[model samples]
Target chain A: GAGVSQSPSNKVTEKGKDVELRCDPISGHTALYWYRQSLGQGLEFLIYFQGNSAPDKSGLPSDRFSAERTGESVSTLTIQRTQQEDSAVYLCASSLVAGGTQETQYFGPGTRLLVL
Target chain B: AQSVAQPEDQVNVAEGNPLTVKCTYSVSGNPYLFWYVQYPNRGLQFLLKYITGDNLVKGSYGFEAEFNKSQTSFHLKKPSALVSDSALYFCAVRASRLTGGGNKLTFGTGTQLKVEL
Candidate 1:
């Protein structure tokens, strides 16, 4: 079975530019999540999407960070006016269920973003 | 308000010796604990989790974790370490309160495990 997959293994963008990272969750996974790994902040959850419901954006660092998951499949994380501090490994994970103790999130290879 | 802590940034062990990676967590009620390992340039792989019943939970690659409610710790252990086991180890925790983000896991800074021969 194919695990989660993220596009653009590496991206180097200007500090003020916008960047979009894509993720393809495993087939039939109803819950998807985005997280970032950085030297300064370690690992932090960015956002989550569960079948058709309003996405949980509480973990998003700022307004510039947004994500959209359409119909329980693909997800896109966009950072508008990226800052140098946004440089990090953006990871995507998906689980069978929305939220529960039994939910085990499988992670993707991650998209490394370098905001220069 | 749930959080996890890996006290030591790194743990060094001999290939044939016992190894232990410390992990402590703070959460509201009954906590669900998990362990994950990450090789360089790869995503994290789930190792094991503690959700109920027994205090001792076994996981992949001969690894296991013991859950201690009184100590608020879930330490990963292996009887004999392997050189290939060297990698970044993360401890995560989630409270079973069923709040909006309560099920969302909180990970520690991670511990670097080095197994030498």
Candidate 2:
């Protein structure tokens, strides 16, 4: 079985530039999530999508951050006008289903973004 | 609010010695606790989880976690530490009711486990 995967293992960009990070979830996984890992903020959940219902964007730090999932398979997290503070390793994960509070999430290698 | 605490910033153990990584959590409802390990420059790997029934749950890579309802803790343990076990450890928790947090796992600050030779 293929695990979750992310694009652009490393990205270096100037401040104020927008970046789009892609995620390919495991086959048949109906739930996808994005999280950020930084030196200051250990790991913070960014957004989540379950099936086709409304996505949970409560964890998005600001309006500049948004994500979209094409159906239930692929997801992209975009950070508009990126700031130095936004530099971090963006991680994606997926699970077999969405509920029961016991679902295990398989994680991706992550995209390391560096805002210079 | 659901939360997890990994009080120790780091834990060091010699190879062949027993190791423990402490984790405590808080939630409005019953908790689903989990443990994960991360090596440098890699994604996190699931070690084990405690949902119900068993207080002691064994998982991959010879790792196990004990769920303590009274102490609100789920600590990862290995009978004999190996140098390869050195890595960053994270503990996470989710509420059973799916309210408040809504299946979103809350993770700890993480603890660095250094297994020496």
Candidate 3:
């Protein structure tokens, strides 16, 4: 079975520009999540989606960060007016159920974003 | 508030020696603890988790973790380390309170494990 997949294995965008990163979760996964990993740092939670819409967007660093999942399958994370600090490895994960209690999440390869 | 702490930044050991990676967590309710390993340029892979029952939990690649409620720690261990086992290890925790939002997992800064021959 295919695990989660993220597009644009690597992206280099200029600061102040907008960048969109895509993720395709495994089939039938109802819960999806986004996280960022800076160099020598841990995974930082960003946002989460359940059934095509996000209910917990608290982890988003700022208003400039947003994400949307369509058809409960694919998700897109958009960074508006990217800052140099936004440079990191963006990771996507998904789970079979929306059980926000104790389910394990499967992660994707992640897309590395570099803001020059 | 929920959080996890990996006290050590790195752990070095010989290939045939025992290895241990320590993790401590703070949460409101009964905590669900997990261990994950990440190779360079790859996503994190689930190693093992501690839900309930026995204090000793076994996981992938001959790895295991012992849960100690009194100490508030879950330490990963392996009988013999392998050179290939060198990577970044992370400890995560999620409270079982069933909040309205979702099961948000809190991760530690991660520990780098280096196994030399």
Q: Pick the winner on lDDT between candidates 1 and 3.
A: 1
* DockQ of the two-chain complex in candidate 1: 0.70
Model 3, residue A116: distance off in Å is 0.5
Error of 3 at A82 (Å): 0.6
Error of 1 at A102 (Å): 1.9
Stretches of candidate 2 off by over 4 Å are B98-100
Model 2 over residues B1-117: C-alpha lDDT tens digits?
A: 888999999999999999999999999877889998999999989988888898999999999999999999999999999999999999998888545567577899999999999
Per-candidate iRMSD: 1.4, 1.3, 1.9
Per-residue lDDT tens digits of candidate 1, residues B1-92? 88999999999999999999999999887888999999999998999999889999999999999999999999999999999999999999
Q: CA lDDT, every prediction?
A: 0.92, 0.91, 0.90
Task: Give the local distance difference test score of model 3.
Answer: 0.90
- Label model 1 with its docking quality class: medium
Model 1, position B3: C-alpha lDDT score: 94
- Which lDDT tens digits does candidate 2 get at residues A22-102? 999999999998989999989888888999899989899999999999998889899999999999999999999776645
Chain B: TM-scores of all predictions:
0.96, 0.96, 0.96
- Mark the regions of model 1 whose C-alpha exceeds 4 Å error after superposition: B97-101
Docking class of 3: medium
User: What TM-score would each prediction reach against the true structure?
Assistant: 0.97, 0.98, 0.95
